[model samples]
Target: MAEQDTVRVGAFTVGMAEAEGWVRRYFDESRNREVAATGGRTRPYAYPVYDRFAAGGAESELSDGDLLAPSLLNASLGIRAVYNLQTLRPRLEKGLAAIPPTLTLTDAAARGTLASLLTDLFGVLDGPDPAVGLGLTTLSKILHRKRPLMIPLYDRRVKRCYCGDSGDHPVEPVSRSAPDGPFYAAVAAGIARDLAEQPVQWRYLASVAPADVSLLRVFDVVAWERGGTRDA
Candidate 1:
């Protein structure tokens, strides 16, 4: 899609409010309690593991890096018992393992630490699942965690604003070889950075989502809304 043809879409989800709101509500006290009470207790279990893996600490009897830890491997148990991501463990693991085990990003601004980490994970030509690459995975992770992380839309919604449908959730693929299409990830990062009022919290994210995953498809969702901040 041409830059001129693209228009923006307000973030939204479910028919109630913007995607951000939907996310906030989902994470709200009641929902969290409900999910937890009704066997939705995934975050509790996985978070500690995730934290340990992220910090390269001790989660098991062995050293943090001893076996790439279950969290590093994207163990479904974490998603199911802790984060409740409800997707392919390997795919999630790809994203988790792909991230660098650090906080600082080389070009923290252009890609942020975590986002850039995804780039490092998939941008490689010899990487494991070279299909989606780091870009798309990062975008996918951003959208999925936006509500939880509080970052604004990644920008594909903005990129294809008035351009019309490209027959997919994310219009483009993160990388050229990513199994998906468009490079929508490039679109998300590009447009989000162009904005002047982007959220502060999600600024630094080192993430990945294996190869061939659409990032969006991994969560089975799509963006929809009207207008947003014209100033920022």
Candidate 2:
């Protein structure tokens, strides 16, 4: 199929050409990290964390590295100073146990399951204190790492892509202060529909993207790169 083919994903109609462009950009960025590592910079946190978690199997509990991954990815080193791993481990583990390791957000039932999980997990992760407290961006990042096929990353750019109103004026970005479980489910459902309807295209995208990145992440990069600027 030509890259220009468009598919409905979430609230937006995404073009394959555009999606491929953005996903390719994301791959290039991932490659750039390798270059950075050659310059003596520390190894990347994303793939390493993912590989470690996958290697340990679903029966394993979240480790200190799991907590630190999103923290470092978000550039919040201070989280380590106050976040009590012992205090949060049980809750985090409980939440993870409820969601199957191989779950994918690809249907109504799956979307509902994702919503319920996000509702419960978000409550556990978002707090007034900075330690356990994380905004949507960080929270989504953590969940995306844990369930790559199910959760889409929801940073500011992604919010702009899905939450904006159609008008001449710019829409205000959605608040990251709290998690919106329904919104996430909606996004998941849309992506599921796209993938279900466009299997060949999704397979093509998967083939082109980094092996470690999930289909969810592929769509995320597409939306993210296509998403409007914060001020736009």
Candidate 3:
């Protein structure tokens, strides 16, 4: 009998076949789709925006141009629709400026700093303006650009895959007053361990993923593709 090819993802053990299948599916849908399944000009892929952001230099401090990074990736169309750029600018500038440009999820020494940055970013969504559209998903997208090696994208699907939160009872938007640091810190730690423990698996996944994508991003694609339907 053949040994099962698997890797640990947070609390779940995922088969390599399943993970790779999702990665391929994601790329096809994002990169190769000529039309939406529903039929329209296929929405733009986020990678172009990512490339543009990188071209400008992925600095620790937020720049006017860098704001474009988070808005393009997800289904939301754009972050600006929800967040007033002027309202978000100051907080984003201060919060992101504190994060080290070189930080990665695997760095144990920088765990506290990572958590602190997440906590501060989450505040943008929870701040005084109830109309502001920012959420955990957008905050994560922004951080992923700034620290792609360290931050994983955390959309509804990724949340479903990792947290086991299903569509029926969707995860609630986090309150401003909630302590955000510990949860994201734990999430980052689990991903760190997953990447650290499975070198062979990571290498295979990386080799198959789109060039220039970060390890964290490759995992995010795999996890989001899994959704809540499959534990693997």
Candidate 4:
């Protein structure tokens, strides 16, 4: 069997053991409090907007205000970007329409579909620096809320953590130079495998979200905690 620490999905490899350790540490009382302190505060409008979508809300129900709410919230959390809702409205509507409410993480097809969808959305932005255009983190948050179970958040910390890069040498967005379909699929598969193989770890996450916590969300917490500090 392969080592639990090293997970290889296609050409991409992740330090699962390090991520697991962070998850474990994050559950500790003192550590949990410390990490929670650094976490993003809830934006009142954001939750309702997300809840509406999660409850099978139609794409037509989404407005420019709905899309911009999360982006503004992201800016508050220190993920910076300038989004023109008026310009991007049509594209955002198309992208949201592409998302099936029944999407599942366990479905192999979902990853490729999501990656293509993200690429389309990311391509809609007009900016000099692709990195700063739509903002990878902001996009991830939007996707996560849209499909909480299927999409994991991909901020600077999570990207750096997964790529094993230093803050001084941040990695590029997965969609910048190439289609990130395979890469996103690999990550989704890896996280699903980890959760399946480790029931104890999955159970540990119940302390974070008792009733319903997606494995993608668990990975998000681990990545945020680990990446914000240092490489494990």
TM-score of each predicted structure versus truth:
0.33, 0.70, 0.71, 0.56
Q: Largest TM-score belongs to which candidate?
A: 3
Task: Return the candidate ranking by lDDT, descending.
Answer: 3, 2, 4, 1
Candidate 4 lDDT, tens digit per residue, 1-232?
3654554221233565665565455334454445445777721222223333343435434444455445433533222343454455566667656666566555533345644654555455434534344555565665566566666667666555444333332233443344343444344454555555555545555345423445566666665655566434
Cα RMSD to native, each candidate? 11.9, 4.9, 5.0, 7.2
Q: State the C-alpha lDDT per candidate.
A: 0.32, 0.59, 0.61, 0.50
Check candidate 2 and list the clashing pairs: 3-17
- Measured with C-alpha atoms, the lDDT of residue 228 in candidate 4 is 65
Per-residue alpha-carbon lDDT of model 1 for 77-132, expressed as tens digits?
A: 22222222222233444544544333222223345553444444323323453432
**lDDT (Cα) of model 4:** 0.50
lDDT of 3 by residue, 63-129 (tens): 5556556656743525564347546667767776666666677674235455565666555655355
